[model samples]
Target: MILPIVAYGHPILRTIAKDIAPDYPELNQLIADMWETMYYSNGVGLAAPQINRDIRIFVVDSKQIFENMEPGEKNEYPGDEGIREVFINAHIKTLNGDDWPYNEGCLSIPKIREDVYRPEEVTLEYVDENFESKVATFTGITARVILHEYDHIEGKLFIDHIKPLKRKLLKSKLDDISKGKVKVDYRMMFAK
Candidate 1:
């Protein structure tokens, strides 16, 4: 099932998600539906908040993004080939390396893309879909995508990282998205 992604300004988007236990109801089903929803929306990553679930969970699949990048491209993203994974109850232990600017888009904030700067590498600790806890490090596009999703669980949006003037310029568009005025191919749930 492809769940309706909640648009920006929704209360759930700003709520700090809670951690789920291994026995959480319909965990597998929710994860499956999230993958379906993400693929349907052509998104590289999706968070639980985007789907109106206030849980600490997110999914990432960077294969498509990596496939489109050329080997000799100016922005060389390493170790991102065919990377796909699920993160639950994630915590960023450390954000290392220099800050790099990358154009980012979110399924919840459709048709809005912006250049957001993030650390080049991240050390994250989280549980996988099976509820097994693990600590891992990621870099390049993988890290970027993970960091973006991580922000969702923490009640933060990429727009918050942009300059105040740039955000002000996008106010109307953001408002339109909240009121279901934005046009997007995927299904969405607007704030009431």
Candidate 2:
């Protein structure tokens, strides 16, 4: 299920998503489709809003690039594990730290990477597909992805993280992209 990713300028991208109710029909199927679409697009994470839907849901699978390492081991962050995780009506109660900054990019704003400062760690609570409440703590790249996708549900863009100067410099390029006057080289911009 390769869903069409909504680009910038779409109004739905700015609206706060509604929470998924426990009895909502098609919830399960929607999650499945999102996973399929995310993998098909080669994204580490995908949000409902990215697909032009105003729903508070996103999928993330980092195992494709990261794998867990033992304590004191170098670069020990956990990988995607190829399991597509669904976060419905997620809430981040706390964000801790300020020293770490990571370069981030978004599918919606393809081919642009910027140094975005985010909490190095986060505490998140959300409901799973079966309507069960779950809480998890994440750090490093995983935390970065979580925060980025979470912003999507609230109608936020990665460009919003940039300073005024950079924004001005990128204005024309962004405009060209939004108007379909130019094609973004996503691979060159975001390849790890």
Candidate 3:
């Protein structure tokens, strides 16, 4: 099912999501619907908050399967073993490195892209859809995707990662969004 995506300035987007507790009813179904919504919307990742659910959960498939394939390629593989990963009540433990810059964008921020610095790699511990505990290390695009979605669980947006000057320039536009004066163009903004 295609769920309505919450836009920038939505109160839920700025509020920290509550942690998912064990034995939550319909947790499995919720995760499944999140995956369905993500694929239907052509999004590589979707956070619970983005769907107006304030829970520390998100879905990610960052192997570029949603993007166009190169010529002569019969089949495109996302390469990540777990194509659709569900992170619940997640926490990160930095494994190494200080920080590195990477260009980032958000599903909520439509048409905006900017460079943000974050840990190049990280060790994450979280519960799976079945509430099974797990831990793993991630790097590169996968790491980037994880970090991006993780921010949503904490009431943070990618725009907050931009330089002060850039953020200042965008303040008015953000204000318009907060006031519901602008509509988000998801297709043009997220299509790769």
Candidate 4:
């Protein structure tokens, strides 16, 4: 049940997603497919919009990043091991701490990685897979992953946080993605 990820320049990626109720059709199945698709694509997260569904839903499994780290490598972000969870109707309650630049990439925009500055910590109010509400704070790599997927629900992309000059230089590459010229291992649905 791996769904095709929507490619860059897709209108759905630009459109703000809508919130869904617990009664939304096939909720469990959809979330399951998302997880499958994410793992298949080697992504830490996948937003509903990325799958051509304009809804406030996304999944994250930062644990993979930590689990796959080199033997001698150390965790840069203190107290951040990793997490596997689902976010529904997520809303940022606060974004705190200093901004740090991290190399970021998206499943929608393959072969394009850029450094984007983002807050070190974020407090969010969201519902879990069961539709149970919860409020939590995240930091380090987990925070970055959450914020990145959050952007998808907000009709924004990581590239939007980069410098204009840098983004300009990537214009051709971006265009190639839109027209289905870029190559990716995972399945993707292009705008063109």
Top candidate (lDDT): 4
Q: Candidate 3: misplaced stretches above 4 Å? A: 65-83, 181-192
- Alpha carbon lDDT of each predicted model: 0.92, 0.75, 0.76, 0.95
Better of 1 and 4 by lDDT: 4
TM-score each candidate: 0.97, 0.85, 0.82, 0.98
Q: Write the per-residue lDDT of candidate 3 for residues 41-157, one digit (tens) a residue.
A: 667899998888999999999756424445444132233332458889889876565677877877777656788998767789999887889988876567778989999999999
Give the clash count for each candidate: 0, 5, 0, 0
Better of 3 and 4 by TM-score: 4
Pick by TM-score: 2 or 3, better one: 2
Query: Per-residue CA lDDT of candidate 4, range 56-77, in tens?
Result: 9999999999899875553477
Instruction: Report the Cα RMSD per candidate.
Output: 1.2, 5.1, 5.1, 0.9
Candidate 1 accuracy as TM-score:
0.97
Give candidate 1 misplaced runs (Cα > 4 Å): none
lDDT of 1 by residue, 1-192 (tens): 999999998999999999999999999999999999999999999999999999999999987787777767525765646469999999999999999999998988889999999999999999999889899999988899999999999999999999999999999999988889988899999888
In model 3, how large is the Cα lDDT of residue 76?
24
- Best candidate, TM-score-wise? 4
